[model samples]
Target: MAQSIAIVSPAVTIDNTLGALFVGFTVACCVYGILLSQIYTYLTHYPMDRSIYKLIVLLILTLETVDQALIGQIYYHYGISNFSNPLTLIEGAQTWSFILQQTLGSVVGAIVKIAFALRVWRFSQRNFWITGLIMILTLGGLSLALVFTIKSFMLPDVFSVVKLRVLGTISLGVGVLTDIITASSLCYFLNKLRTGYRQSDSLVSTLIKYAINTGALTSVVSITTVILYNIMPNNLIFIGVFFILSKLYAISFMATLNTRRVVRGKGTDRQNTTANHTNIFHLGTRVPSMGPSDMAGWETAYTATSATQQEFDQQRPIIPLNTTGFQDPTLGKRPAM
Candidate 1:
């Protein structure tokens, strides 16, 4: 009797499922990115500076497209004998894309958190101590992400075998910590703005909801990737899971950024309307109580009188007052007497 062992090829139908998911996610991100770009253009045409933030988000979406394309290629080429050989250019491309996807996700997450923190600082007038603390935390989180990215890629000989597992664990932990810090800061600002009630509440609620959703998605992806990597150990199923999770994460991030642009745009419009009203009042066209030049003259005269009184007191006896009290030539006082 002869016994035969079954050899498992590192490919499966799951690759196709992942490919379909990636394509769907890519299309969604592209559409959302286009909308964001159009919104950015509209806001910039109104001359709002916040358009710059939207532009940064557009760049992130572009990166997501690249990441998805690479993953799609990997999935499409799966199990092809010519490309399945380990260390071949195709395999290298797949590995590099996965690494890049992870790195870009981490960077974009940190950037979005930083943007929120900055917006809070700008709008809420939070104390320097609070702002400083948030800044330190944001920077610390970013630095940790960068360190993991460098370590994961730089020591491939030592890391490639278990790097995904290690990096995934680290990424999950850091992502959680960053999310918590950001959420707490957001809550603090929201609480501070409680008196503003409706507008502030709505803005904060939207921000928190999206931030939490994105954070939760990222955590799930990171944790799932880690578990799959450990369990399958270089199996194609793990790769499929990784790609699917990455696409989901990218789509979620793009959505949040797009929502933020809309919120910021509305805020700018309100500000412009308020500024216009203020301009009308200042120009004396709205209130009509005082012309601009009259107000200016009155202020100047008041200021001159106060200064003269102060100077006379300072130089007590040095200045003399005439008994005639600087005669008004138009009304001669001596003739009347």
Candidate 2:
């Protein structure tokens, strides 16, 4: 009896680990999804392109939140007690959410990659090499998304051990490739900006740096998931990693937004200073008395103008012209012949 109990302990330990990871992932998803939603709301006041990208990210966040919640509940039921009766429902919900999450995640990833590529393309209009490189990266991202979505759904029983391992492996490869393409494209744009030293290069360089960093972080999570899945074929620690990846992605986006705001604030400050100086110069020219001189100078100028008027009146000679050839006795008039 003791040996039998000992043999069952490992299975119990695995189930508990899976349960804890699922719960942790669920909570992270909830927090990250809310963050993404807030970002979407903030971007809605921006242009349509920016709003659309935020909306796509928001949708992905929502899907991930639901996926994690459902999986976490399923694992909770499976691990917490002898509630085997709800196994069918748990399985169905888990499968459905997993499928939706994978599909939406792929789509969102592709969309963001394309959006960044388009931004780079816009900036590098005269550089065909950079533009072509961005296009290729966009194409690769889209292809990876398409392949992953189709492959994930091709097998209905995705929760099975074989399907999980196979799908996870394929996703790992695709994710790595996608990361490489994105990172390389962003680095190329950064290099181009550095070489050209264009006026608007700093903003582009910052954005590229953020994208590369976020892509690399996501790739690490994907690689970690792949390794963990391979080592512990039935464990669910991968879910915790997924949660961490989701939160990190959201935080990176928030950081990007904050960076943009700081850059915009600096630009606005410079513009305001220029406009203020222009206004002051125009005002000073119109009202010379309001120039940056002392009040004593203004008073002195007023006194000098008054004295000049008096002198002008005093210096003017009193001359009179008579219509007739003779002047009257009582009148002091000069006659012109």
Candidate 3:
């Protein structure tokens, strides 16, 4: 009994230490996500952003709160009081902590995925076909997530559940696929939307960068979790990555939201140019027929408007010229002097 207890306890301790380390990392990331969300809220006013956008962000933040709480509870159970007990390793899989984590995380994933799909829809100018297809893929992933959560509760233990394979594999696989599609679609359209100008194209490029970072981060995280689950089915190493996926997505969305002001600021600077109604065209890798700086000079020279034209006329002095047939009075009167 002493030998068995010694071997088992050490192994359990190792697992718990890793579990704590991962959950600690997850908590730190959650704090960062919340901070990002708050920054987004502060910058975007209610009227400036539609009610739906605000509400979705609210939902994601709320879910993140609950998810973080669940992880904390499980972390306490494994790391603090039960690290030395091997029996407690699988104990978490059957608890409410596990269930809520699965459910809430899945819901948050769906929310963010749909939000991105809506963005795609808007970018496409309400094109039903494109939006519909993306939404379909997102919904499919969400459905699989729902099934995985439901089945998790029905299962006996983490070991038994993971052995089923199809449930966990499909849910995560579909999620990765959805993220790839969403990110790629955004990049493709954002590239198309680039105006080849400094300001707007810079904004679009920023958006593409965000899309790539978030999408790749989540996709790689998901794949890692899936691989760990497959290889170390009995170990809870994958739990750490699995737990943070939703928060990553939420933070990504908030980061995207926060940058809207930056994009709008760049775009707002352009309103003056548009309102002026000048015709300096910009093209990719091609010189304009008239440069923007030159356009102002051209406009002053041939502006049909009375206001800008009159100002130029007043700025010039009326110089008197001497002709060959007639001399100026001031020059002719010099002889009498």
Candidate 1, residues 1-337, lDDT tens digits: the string is: 0011012223323333344334545554565465456545434432332445447656666765676666545444432432334233222433455456556656655666566566446434555766677667667756766676666666443125455466456655665565565556655554544334455446556555655665576567656656766775544444444444444544554454345335443222222232211111110011111233433322222111224434655687654556567655786456654
Best by lDDT: 3
Candidate 3 lowest-lDDT run of ten: 280-289
Looking at candidate 1, the ten consecutive residues that score lowest on lDDT are 277-286
Residue 142 in model 2: lDDT: 52
Of the candidates numbered 1 and 2, which has the greater lDDT value?
A: 2
Per-residue CA lDDT of model 3 for 30-110, tens digit only, reads 664675656466444323444556677777777887888787776776556765764555444566786778778888888
* Every candidate's CA RMSD: 15.7, 19.0, 10.7
Estimated TM-score per prediction?
Answer: 0.53, 0.57, 0.71
Clashes of each: 0, 0, 0
Task: Give the clashing pairs for model 1.
Answer: none
Backbone clash total, candidate 2:
0
Best by TM-score: 3
The runs of at least 3 residues in candidate 3 whose Cα sits more than 4 Å from the true structure, single-residue gaps closed, are 1-13, 16-48, 81-85, 91-93, 272-337
Cα deviation of 215, candidate 2, in Å: 2.1
Model 3 accuracy (lDDT, Cα):
0.65
TM-score of candidate 3 to 2 decimals: 0.71
